[model samples]
Target: MSQAPVVGVAVFVVKGDKVLLGRRRSSVGHNTYALPGGHLEFGESFEECAAREVKEETGLDIKDIQFITVTNNVFTEAAKQLHVVAVIMRASLVDPEQLPQNVEPEKCDGWDWYDWKNLPQPLFQPLETMLKNGFSPFPAKLN
Candidate 1:
């Protein structure tokens, strides 16, 4: 059997120099810090996927969902391999005072904003791929 790359939507919810991340509890990258997102559903726009997944996982409403970049990531497990075309995005909270909660504790530990330049250790693979390529949502224009 053959498999195709699935679309994985990830959102960077930016506030000042900080972005939100959660410690994943899922199998794909268990225990690694990752952004709020999930697989895109059929017929759903990238923006819609971004908004829905963030809200579903973190209980956070976001706006200004903008296309950031895409990374082709391939993961391998014993006798299995998965490929994903990760559609990365950037957004802001609908309300600046809105706090993130662990809406889906089964999937993630919790969500909290962290400095982009000083991210948490053991980042999820796809995110690590992005950083290795010099991707920074926050340019000097942000500060």
Candidate 2:
């Protein structure tokens, strides 16, 4: 039997002109850069999921969470197919002075802020999809 597609929440925490990203360490997207987020929990709103995932993975508090866009991602690894519906969100860090740390060493290495125009290479599949679709979290550019 096949499993249903999982819904994931990808949060872009903006601080000044940069967005926070984590270098993944897990098998799913190992060695790829991705936003701080994870699978959505039952009965949880997108904002709640974003905040929770950010804090849990990056140790940062985020607020003003808002919907950005969604990407339908279907990919395969090790001959195993996987499908994920990625719900993208954008927000600002609640405390600008607080730096991001690697809270989940098993899944992520550490977090860093990067400019949108010059993002790091080898981004996670879903994030790459969003960029290809011209999805920008910045208010000045939506496409």
Candidate 3:
């Protein structure tokens, strides 16, 4: 029997025309760009997980966290099958002036702002699922 798919929360922080992203260095999506998120901790809501993950990985507090979409992602890499249930959310920085930094240098290369239309290549699977399903994080004002 295989293990159950892990549940993860992906927080999309939009500022103007760009969204916050980080290049992953860990196994699941190593060398691929992804939103700042991780496994859902026990007793934490999806919004709570999004906020906590953003703060933990990006060194910024996120506000207005709202549910966006969910994706069931299944993929195989190097003959190892993996699956994940991804909870996607949108948020903004509590302080606009606060910049994001790499809080987990061992797991991530760094954080950067990328235009939605020009996202970096080799995106993490969950994120690619969102994009393929027409998920957009840009605020109405910017869209």
Reference-based TM-score of each model: 0.93, 0.92, 0.91
Question: Between which residue pairs do clashes occur in model 3?
Answer: none
Instruction: Name the better of 2 and 3 by TM-score.
Output: 2
Candidate 2, TM-score vs. the true structure? 0.92
Taken over the whole model, the C-alpha lDDT of each candidate is 0.91, 0.88, 0.88
Model 1 residue 11 CA deviation in Å: 0.2
Model 1 residue pairs with clashes = none
* Model 2, span 28-49: residue lDDT tens: 8889999988899999999999
lDDT of 3 at 121: 86
**17: Cα error in model 1, Å:** 0.4
RMSD of each candidate? Answer: 1.8, 2.1, 2.0
Residues 14-95 of candidate 3: C-alpha lDDT, one tens digit per residue? 9878999899998778899999998999999999999899999999998999998788877677357778888989998899
Q: Estimate, for each residue in 28-88, the C-alpha lDDT of model 1 and write its tens digit.
A: 8889999999999999999999999999998899999999888898888525678989999
Candidate order by TM-score, highest to lowest? 1, 2, 3
RMSD of 1: 1.8
